[model samples]
Target: MTSMNHNQRRGRVVIGVDTHKHIHVAVALDDFGGVLGKEKFTADTAGYGQLIDWSMTHGHLLTFAIEGTGSYGAGLTAAVRRRDIGVVEVMRTDRRDRRLRGKSDFLDAENAARAVLAGHADAVPKTADGLVEMIRTIKVAKDVAVKARTSAMISLKAVLVNAPAPLREQLQPLSKMALIHRCAGLRPGSMTTVEAATKHTLRSIARRWEQLNDEITAHEKMLAELTTTLAPQLCAAFGVGADTAAEMLIVAGDNPERVRSEPAWARLCGVAPIPASSGMTTRHRLNRGGHRQANAALYRTVIVRMQHHEPTKSYVARRTAEGKTKAEIIRCLKRLLAREIWSLMRPLRINPQTVESAA
Candidate 1:
């Protein structure tokens, strides 16, 4: 089975990897997207070695594109890169779009491989041993914490809704520090003992929410450390704190060279607008393409910039006077911020202000 999979006659091979948590499937395709060989294996050392060996025996593994490199895709990409194997991280096919045709792991893997071979898929490979993956993991943690915090808030609000006005007043400050204290005794006076017992269950939920707050803070500190160490250069600027810098740097991936243009970064963040034209009209709107997570991080930075500092305030006011709406102005500012970010992250040339001075 391994030999059949390892056949050198697989033609010029472009590999597509369908990534999941426990297992990964890789298919080698010829130039015409014909499947030369396909194998399903666990995403462990033995599995990685088998896949690499298969590719090396065939033509050089020209490009390996995997979907969602930041999630389940991380382990596979890291494994491949460790073997000096080149990887192309493809975006996942939209489930709705995929369903329009059909849905299966086989189809997903084929679409990914075909995307790479057809020149339709271009993924920015991470550099410095996939540090972007590590930073991206922190983002996952941050998001989890956010959800936990939100759940806690929702529970608090539920309590407020059910409690009498007096009880609400007691808990209102908790809206501010509500998640800080334990919710062991929270109960509505109107409820019977049974109802009270169930209501108190919400207190347990609130306690869990408090734990999430601590976790969120801890993950944020770890994210800060990533910037402080791997990308201290990114954090050197005003308004670009550890979280902002780390998010930017992570999506930038250590391989800044893979992103050839500032517009590429902007597009990846979905902050750059697309030009839509009719027979006689030409207008640009917010880019509907690229990674939404990266776009969101940049959007948050824009909000932070507008509210936090002088230059950002002046820029917003100036753009507003020039007749741009709030949405239009934000889009413009995000692009500008993208350019500044690209300059600071000049992959080929290190600015003295970045890693050097910090070092």
Candidate 2:
């Protein structure tokens, strides 16, 4: 039988990483929170291997505390976990701490390790290697297309407002779609005159809008298909559509098990009620923090249920009869929806260990 090495015999160690575009700063610490070593490595596969090997020299690497796990640190986090090491998502160092202790990449990396050791940062980073990632990418494209289309429409209208009287008269009375079709069909033979210039610009903007519409449609179709495939139960749930399901999935991340619980999921979506108690007054208020997009998805789900679901309508009516305000009712509905969505998403959960192994 092979004998255990010194580093291997050591109980456990933690590594903290401060990641950047081209480089990463790492700090290693023992179980008792003593610094082992610090090093800088290139932000690449080779560098990841070197960093892991170096950390293992100090002790058994039990976990990594990483900052910006969704952005700059994502690659490093993925790389480390691929070796079956645990990774915790660490928030950036508090500004107050930076002011008092000063700031440097090495210091930040050390702080990350200390935070994890102190039990201050315990959340697992998302595994962005699955269908949820694909949906997020598609949603981003769709968002840009929608924004561009709106801008094109606004510009088209603004130009018409100042266009030549004859051209304005010719286009102003048309409906929005009709105006776009007409402008796109315009034959601007000459750009030498102001009227011709107006026609040319309008035609360009209208055509761009049409193209964006097509792009958005394609993205939506793709999103619907992907969301359904990823979470059919979520997609089939009352008041949950492709867009809402996609947003929820993105917020929960590719590995839903990292969410911990339904309340944690609600907090992530900004639907968790925050306690606002005073000496003689005990009350909870709406949470304004968390992912706004996810909150909006929950709101949209509530709206759909309010409008069409019989049981939801009854609940609303009963709440109103008991003197609850519409906003309060909506808040309650959102919390309920959050719980429902979390339950549905749980079945699709991927074990965090599986994520690390598959990384």
Candidate 3:
């Protein structure tokens, strides 16, 4: 009897893709994890179509394991999903595994398929085609502008410290904002002396700071408007402002359903308690692995509530009386806040206006 080919025996296929800026390498494996075909395609519309068609010929397209779904693979993921094909985000192969198996584009592509077949790569890639993406873009711009402004201020201060006596004496006592304003208004006309040159440099830096401040303000305003429109209830939640709300929204992505459950969300925020049990030392420890920005947002919310919300203040007092350290109390509070935020975020994925209408 003739031996059946692997594709014929398995019938179903999985495609693994290693994406890059200009090209994507793909490998197709049968249900039994046998490589059927491997190909390289350009990272564009035509290439995506060819890749899909190429994989389909091996057998039925089961799912796609793609690296960098949020970065280089984003467009391809969207394209595949639009055609109703399943896609999962695959992180880079472990260094140890790479070292053992040896490395090549085909090897990485095959690894991605093996990961999917073995259930190692099961994360649903984010559908970054929504208002949250817009918020992320604006936030990134604002963050860069703020950093530049801060650097400019630091350099301006450094110059001021070494400035000529006449200029230093004039500006040394001014507060930060006042100093920027004063330097921006300096009328240093000629580079006749060291003091004049110093004044000119300070003025330029101050003007740049002013421009960045305006840019940040504009971005904040856009964030406020978008957050209010997307999830008014989240924005209105006690102690949650536009910046904090926006950060959390970005973490949850446009389709929060992929987050799975509240516990998962808590883990994503790094507020979940991790089991640290050993032989007879059963306990939990604070998790330190999730999105740090989301953790900071939760921390800020807890602080605001502790200061102004009566029930939270009473809870704090009770915890303190129960011998909990301040840090421990904050950790507990962060976990609780993460659960509450998760509850609020779930409805957002389905209908962002649900909370607003209820209110």
Q: lDDT of each prediction vs. the true structure?
A: 0.73, 0.89, 0.89
Question: Which stretches of candidate 2 lie above 4 Å from their native place?
Answer: 1-6, 350-359
TM-score of each: 0.77, 0.93, 0.93
State model 1's lDDT.
0.73
Give the clashing residue pairs of candidate 2, or none. Answer: none
Which consecutive 10 residues in model 2 have the weakest lDDT in total?
Answer: 350-359
lDDT for model 3 comes to 0.89
**Candidate 1 lDDT, tens digit per residue, 69-171?**
8667776777778877678878778788687989777678888988888787876666545455567778788987898789777876776567656555665
On lDDT, the leading prediction is: 2
lDDT tens per residue, model 3, 144-210: 9999999999999999999999889989999999999999999888889888889899999999999
Candidate 1 TM-score over all chains jointly: 0.77
* Residue 102, candidate 1: alpha-carbon lDDT: 94
